[model samples]
Target: MVTERLSMRNMTKTYGTNTVVKNVNFSVLPGEVHALVGENGAGKSTLLNMLSGVTMATSGEIFVDGEKAVITKPTDARDYGIAMIHQELQNIPELTVFQNMFLGNPKTKGGVFVDKDREAKRAKEILFELDPDIDPWEKIKNLKVSQQQIVEIARALLANAKIIAMDEPTSSLTPQEFDRLAQLISDLAKKGVSVIYVSHKMDELFRVCDRATVMRDGQYIDCVNMKDMTEESIVTMMVGRKIEKVSHHSYVTDRVMLEVENLGRVGTVKPASFKVHAGEVLGISGLVGSGRTELFRLIFGLDKPGLAVAKHTRMSREIAGLDKPANGKVIVKGESIKLNDVHEAIRHGIGLVPEDRKLEGILKSRSININMGMPSMSKYTKGGFIKRGFLRKKSYEIMKGLNLRPLDVDRAIGTLSGGNQQKVIIGRWLASGTEIFLFDEPTRGIDVGAKSEIYDAIEELAKQGKAILVISSEMPEIIRISDRVMVMRDGEIVAQLEGEDINEATIGQYSIGQAKKQTEAVL
Candidate 1:
């Protein structure tokens, strides 16, 4: 008989007037990988935070190994053998991997002076279990994102945690690293440690979990064995409805809005090329570690495509036998121009909604007014000085356009929900007068209601002839908005589907780098 390791009864959480988590009941059995998945702000993280004692539950009782437990603080959680790895990593950059792993529980000599050598040895042993490739002496700052995650996991295991929860642990990890994590979860489960895996990625959950618990708008929706469901079915349950099949509207025009000729970033992104016309959204998709990001990074001038050199052979012989696409225009409106940088990409009608919003998108300290005013500040600033009054008024205008709630210009940007924060970023660029928008995972951490709003925003942009480039992990999203789709694999445009050709299965195939020969081609 399977025994429950952890259980939460009538778990509820509220923030002032907002009820984020509501009467949620959940359980994790010993040696089970129980997955919790939902759109961002659906209360998944809130419940985890409550269980980990990072935040107090408004009303609830927790049972550990059938014994009622009290966790008022993080230390209480630690003592109860409950550990969590947050989406955003928190490690002292200056500390060594060994030191960070044994942070709070330091060894003491004669119960007074610290014993560094002994702690380092124990830390090393823990790292060996989590990831043998990581060096104990390496500085925490020097580790890759994935390695840093491993260090966090090692730190959790060091506590001898019976229940370890990973919150989007693979968000920054490579595909190989994610596979490694799957195995590590399996290994942890085998050792009788109940693991709670929280992620938005369907593929990862489907591959690894034994059972999945879903939440929606801060309420427990359902719990079911992984074997009894498909990804589509799981998503349907989480969202509370069937997601209609994505249809591509066929009135595509050949007037190319953007064209990349022989774009290259050697080793990172090969000399790749593609074109996107007005009303068409080219979707660049790939497994983690593939250079989908690099290809766009160069195009947006964050990095050069190395085409300025006079020697490299680039483009076909027909376009004047040029060694590269240098001196050739990325031509918007037949105007030969240079993108000063990413900002210039927007100035000339391009806005990129980056994949990792927490890192590249959100500005926590500023208010909604300041955030939206940033990209397009000409109306609010004069001779390098900003006019606060003007900017505040303009912020309201942008908010009204996006139909943002609360309409509070004075509130700090971080206080808003994930979807609202995303809208603020988009609002900034729209104010910048950008005709083309590059949206990378526009709905990543947002909830279902917010997702519908964002999709409407995308369609609205397209109707205004705003050429949008959307790179998304969500297949339904890629299929829903893109008038025509182009899939990227290993940093190259592997497949281009248009009009009657765009469908979930085909785009999905191209997304995972299998669009061509093993074709499940459908319209």
Candidate 2:
């Protein structure tokens, strides 16, 4: 019989009267890449938290190397050779890569002062093993999201961790970066390290994981071999039902609701033009740092817009504008509106669901009702007093419409899963009567089931004749939901694809400038 490297018998967790994680059994073999997958609120996070010593299990027996281990704190887990890398990284942005790597426990000289040379040397060695391009002397703030993730992994490796659990590791990675990460995981497993990989991306799980443990509604379902299961089968096991593939239909109308002419930001976004119809979903696709988010910020009035120097001469000649050659103009409902700030954008009926939901989107400490009604508070208030009853009723109605889990408007938004928190953000805009919606990485870090729900909501909004603009890193998501796609490269829109032209291959080529090079060659 093969002895498991780690095992949890009948693990359970509870808070007051509510049990978040029911009795479940899990085990991982040495050098095995195991997958822990489920929908949001399905107890995957709770289980991992227990294993990593973030939370204590109410009832469970943890065995490491066939010996019982009592891990009550993060230090204990670290001592037991276990590490957890959360989706939201724990590195200090102000510190250098090596400093962040040795944040808690640093190499010391004479047991007093930190040995800077020794720390840097060890950090460089581990970081180089993962990605040689990562400079240990560089500040964490200057590094990309993928590079920051590698630093976290290198830190764990430096600590001689035998088991590492990563949550949504590839959520921010580009295809090339993901490939590198996949290779690193394979290497780690070869070195007798156990990896508990958690993600909503099915293709990734199938590629890197050898076996998968499925959970639903806090209950243990079953563990299955990766080769024996299909995406559809695994999804069914997660959701307890077969989810039908949503067929996207064009809802575009002839009436253009939003139009951008010569929209540009100096040193950021290049001069670009496009139009979104009243009932259309336009997707912006590009590699990281392609100005997709910057464009959205300009449109939403979060940032000031400026003309690219190269376009000023030509644009000045085309449009005879008096005041210093206006960089761009935003037209809504056939009227040019000055979007000077976020309030101006909101007044013009534009709502944005920002990419970093936890940071910019929602007030985590507030209740779901408060978050849902925040943007439209005036509508739910009278005579300097909040209409609590009316607000709750409206919030509950919207939550029900969005299929929010638990259906409790009074619950703290922070306590909810990523999917439900996203629903609250969408519900807020709906209450504000937003006409044009801008979703940035709308489904990022959410589960597959929640992704379907979000797609449905976008479809419904489009069907209602509301103009929608989406910026996403996922190519398949762009192809599946977009009526048209705008591919950006180096802060410029390179290709605008529609219908059959919006596949992964076409987007890939355009995103990397291959299509542009080919076109230039032909010209």
Candidate 3:
């Protein structure tokens, strides 16, 4: 007979009068990959927090290999051979990759001085097993978000963790990276390492997890084998309702609301151009580093556009005082405008929901009403005073339309789940009266139910004649909502597909440079 590797019996957590998790039971067997799944705020994070010793459980008993274990701090969890990789990464930005990997536990010489050489060597070996492109000596701040995620995984592996909990680990990874991670998980399981995986993506769960334990409103619902359930069944269990499939119908208009001509940014973005009509959703499809987010930054004026010419040629043109190198032009409503900064972009009726929402969007400590009303403060200002009641009323309306949870505009935006926070961000631009919307990974880290709601909101925006330009790493989302799709690869828009041409196969082919010549024509 085999005892369970880990178990949580009647686990309960309470914050004052609020009980976020109640009588929840979870278990993992050695060599098994168990999925902890639920909608945002379904007590998944709270439970994981308790298991990882981020927070103490008010009531419950934890068992490892049939022996009760006490985990009161992260160090305690580490002592028990458990590691957690949070969706919101916790790496120190200034530290080098190898240093961050061996942060809390470091190799030491003579049990006193730090052994940098040994740490770097081990880090390189682990990173090679994960992603060889990552350099162990590079600062954590310099790596891409995906690379940073890999570093976190490498840290866990370095600890030789018997049980690892990952929260939405693939939210920032590319398809290739995800495949590599899946293989890694399989290999670890074979080595008798149990993994507790938490993700909002159903497909990923089905692909990687051996079994799933579903939670709802802080209560344990059911646990099922992956082979016995389908995606629809699991989603219904998660949200407590059958989700209606979202269908897309073309809403494109003849009036072009936003046009980009030869937008470039030196090494990051090549000369690229496209037009978005009044009522269209133009989906930008690419891998994580395919310049989708960088292109959006240029369009939103967060970064300055650069001349596509060679460095020396650009310098010569600047010296000669020639007409500003015809690098790019942003035309709004047939009027050519220079978007030199974020203010200029907003003034031109353009709003960006940045790729990294936590860093670039939403003020977490502030109330949802404040965050929603930020871009449109002038509309509610009278005599240098904010009209609080009016702003609250307007914010409630937008929140209701988006089906935002809790319905409390005064709640701190940070306390909400990933899906609700995304809703509030989208509501921000809606309140701002933004006409051309740029959404980067809008549905990332959000559940199926929330994704449907966001898609509906985007459709409604298009119906209102707002031109929507979305950058999504998920190809299914692109195929679902986009009226036209732009496939980018290696900093170039390689193909534009509309109507019959915009299937997943075609888009995937273009994204990886595997498409036929007929489809290689650039827009």
Candidate 4:
């Protein structure tokens, strides 16, 4: 058996009253790919953070090669031959690939004078040694997400990492790029490097990992070899119960509230067409970067489609006579108007819950009330004057309805945790009185306990006659909440499943181009 290179026994992490990860015990053996997986907010990120020295384990012991090693910080872990690749890109976007590769550790030509030429040469050699496709002198900001991932792996190898923890590395990678990465991981295993891979995708785990560890709600459940398990069994273990198999949700709406006849963006979401009725949830389920988010952005006026994938036709306006070639009009109710304008969209009762909540959802400097009540300021303020009392009073009402912890209107929103911050943003739109809501990865970065609350709120909104369009990577969420599922691949809406067809395996098959409209499903 390969010897254990790193061990975390009785690992736990806590913030305030919530325990993010608890009593987790695992080992990474040399020359093996150990996949760590669970649902979103099931403590995978916290566990990886503990191992990577980004966060010190609250109460645990870490052993390196059978010796107790101190890893109170990131530098200490690097000293012990441990490295990590974050889920969110960590490289400096302004810096070149070479500069980022040798950021902290640079070659000195004359004791103090830095040798940039030699540093770039060494960086190129490292990248070539691994992938050879990524150029070291190119600016990191100019590269796609896949190329950035390759650069990160090359840097880890250059540091001579014995234990590497990767958090959802393939989330942004294309199929061909993923295949190359899987092979590279195998090659690294052959060289005796232990790889700890974290992901929620089941197919990738079965293909790439030697053994797997399953965690649920911050607790470690089991660690078993890949050969001994199936996807259903692993999911059952991780979730602690069998998820009831449900077909698609049946919708009873005939009122076409939002119509997209030919909606599209060039090289992004194709000319896509779909109709959503009031009180219905339309789910677009696909892998990351499958243009699920891109499609919704166009509908909400966040971006104008360069090309139309689908166009809408109404009784009043001619679809062919539309000025925009990229796509036709996004019609609300009976009138057809251009959806490519920001002010027009919100005025027409449309609200968007963005994917990156930290960057886009809530304002950092604003108060909780301001974050929640800013959507429709006219309702709370007087004519060309301040109306502070009404704003705070209204914001508190929405926060209470959402079950936010403190319901403190005066508190700065940035001080709250991720879950509470998400509530603030949701509450913001809920106050807007929008008829159509587009939510992209609505429950990301929040804890498991909060996810249930968020889902309940979404269900409430749908039941209240809102046309909801949801884009989520997690298949289970799509199945549990959506009234209809639209499977996308390569920026095209390949299949639309109504009642009795939305299964996780079926969605995966469609998203990967494995199963099509004509082909029978393997599962």
Q: Give the top-scoring candidate (TM-score).
A: 2
- Model 3 residue pairs with clashes: none
Give me the runs in candidate 4 sitting further than 4 Å from their true place.
Answer: 11-24, 37-47, 56-59, 212-247, 261-274, 285-294, 304-327, 337-340, 364-370, 380-427, 442-463, 472-523
Off by over 4 Å in 2: 307-324, 517-523
Per-residue lDDT of candidate 4, residues 1-523 (tens digit)? 6558988999999998889899999898888899987766678888877877889888998998888988888888888889998878789999899888877777888879878899888888888867687778899999888888888887787788889898878755655678888988998999999999986667788999999998888999899999999887887887677655433334436787888867776667766777888888888888777788888888888898654424444321233223345465688887776767866888888889888887888888889998887768888777866588988888898899999876788999887766788888888888888888898888765544456677778778877788889988777889888888888887778888766687887888988888875232110
Given candidate 2, what's the lDDT at residue 351? 94
lDDT tens digits, residue span 1-523, model 2: 8779899999999999999999999999999999999999999999999998999999999998898989888988998899999988999999999999998999999999999889989998998779999888899999999899999999999889999999999888898899989999999999999999999999999999999999999989999999999999999999999999988988899998898877877767766678899889999999988999988999989888874344556555344221245578888888887865888788789999999999999999999999998878999899989899999999999889999998999999999889889999999999988999999999999988999999999999999999999999998899999998988888778888888888999999989878872231100
Query: lDDT per prediction?
Result: 0.77, 0.90, 0.88, 0.80
Specify the poorest-scoring 10-residue window by lDDT in model 2.
Answer: 514-523
Error of 2 at 259 (Å): 0.3
Give the alpha carbon lDDT tens digit for every residue of 275-388 in model 3.
889999999998877889988898888888774354547565444322256668888899887755777888889999877788889899999999999987999999999999
Where does model 1 exceed 4 Å of error?
1-3, 15-19, 108-117, 228-243, 262-272, 287-291, 303-329, 380-411, 448-453, 473-523
Q: Is candidate 1 or candidate 2 better by TM-score?
A: 2
- Each candidate: RMSD to true structure? 5.1, 3.4, 3.0, 6.2
Clashes of 3: 0
Per model, how many backbone clashes are there?
A: 3, 0, 0, 15
Which portions of model 3 show Cα errors greater than 4 Å?
121-150, 307-311, 314-324, 516-523
Better by lDDT, candidate 4 or 3: 3
Local lDDT at 59 for model 1:
98
lDDT of 1 at 433: 81
